[model samples]
Target: MVPFGRLLDALSEVPDPRRAEGKRYPLAPLLLFTVLALLSGATSYRHIICFLEQRRIVLNALFGCTLKRAPSLNTLRTVLQMLDRDALEEAFRQHARDLLPPAEPGRMPVVALDGKTLKGSFDHLNDQKAAQALSAFASAAAILLAHTEIDVKSNEIPAAQQMIAELGLSGVLFTADALHCQKNL
Candidate 1:
């Protein structure tokens, strides 16, 4: 795992989408808090908030969190909704790249590609199905390289193709499900 301070530095440049006048917390710290909570097995906004609340003392001592109180679930939801998705993804990828060891000379990385429906994502109130995402994993390193969401109207085939191509892998061994072994691909 990357050092927490380095992680904070990597995320410091992310643009905050909140109005300046109403900004209660810095975007970098808030994002760091959320990511830390997620890494600790927080799977929902409520869980993340609770994690922050419970670990407030330790977090403040370590990271100098200056929050008067833990952010509410609504605040977290709004910030997440308004966050720049592309910027966040790029930051995450850069951090992951820093953590990954360099490939050996004349050796290619082995990457696994797959798609899975996100559990507990079904929108029962809206009568919508669970969200599906295509992911790329560096096999040896056991870390996710990247991912893309499958459009609601489309299947994994197209999403997988786009994700693999965007990865710009060269001299790399790509493995995937039978669905991606199309003759045209």
Candidate 2:
């Protein structure tokens, strides 16, 4: 596959889940479009398809393709469902790294550790809890630098510490809610 730009180049590293003969849209662009739509408040596959359809013209220009129409909701859903989770996460991490600004000599990065439970993640039939995640956000760049799932959503301190240790972060200011200020944490 041909590289588009920094973001696309990084994203394109992930192998497409769909077979070559069955693909209608390139994986990188499709993933990027989904990310864009989600960031823009698209809450479902239907909303993502709508977001793409409404922006088809601009998307053609942005991706350097002549798409007659956006993909269907089924297409988007299937592609997403079959994607390799680890590969997608690595691609997103690369994209996030590209979006971050270079460190200034005297400035410390402000990272906010925020937790959220994914919508529609609860499974009553299986007695499962909602999926939760703690993300480290770059306050200045407004980008996600890293994240980890909170196995137990009630306490994010462990997840936050894990993310910080995994990133090997230093000289950084961290922020979070009062739940993170417990004596044991």
Candidate 3:
């Protein structure tokens, strides 16, 4: 596998004002990229560091850097928390779009929608006003297409509509349970 440093070098082609001079570490993009890479299969931070260290030779050959150590976990967390979620989401979307195969002109993709609460990640800090999310699934590909957060007291109808609106159903078939049969939905 190509080392993550190499990947970071490639991504660095995109200019970011956030990368100003005198910064202690390039944390946001580095942490975000590292997390995503780890999620893909990198075992641990040490493993990532080892990978990067090996690629350091290559990195120095391409772009000069005097780095010798991988970032600590605490550093990674601090950097990631500061990252702009919308920017990260947009980057993810663009990358996903690029990875997708071209769709045939006449072929309509199948889409399914549904919602469920993530019981494990539930939070109750706001008590009665806490937000809750329901997930919509595209059954054919078994991928989650969209999600909507419902108010604690609100029903699923509004959330369903919000999720549906985010999906592109032109020629695509949508399937859902009776809960989604509401007129406004």
Stretch of 10 with least lDDT, candidate 3 = 92-101
Candidate 1 residue lDDT tens string, 1-185: 33677778778877899898869978888899899999999999999999989987788778876877788899999998998998888777766666677889988888988999999999999999899998889988888888888999999988877877777767788888999878886
The best-first sequence of candidates by lDDT reads: 1, 2, 3
Q: Sort by TM-score, best first: what order?
A: 1, 2, 3
lDDT of 2: 0.81
> Candidate 1 — which pairs collide?
none
lDDT per residue for candidate 3 within 1-185, as digits (tens), equals 23344444434443343456535655433543464457657786666555555555554454455455556665555555665665554444333333334455876656655656655554566454444667655454554545556776786777666656654445666676798776753
Could you tell me how far off, in angstroms, the CA of residue 19 lies in candidate 3 after the best superposition? Answer: 7.2
Model 3 TM-score relative to the real fold: 0.58
**Residue 65 error, candidate 2, Å:** 2.9
Best by TM-score: 1
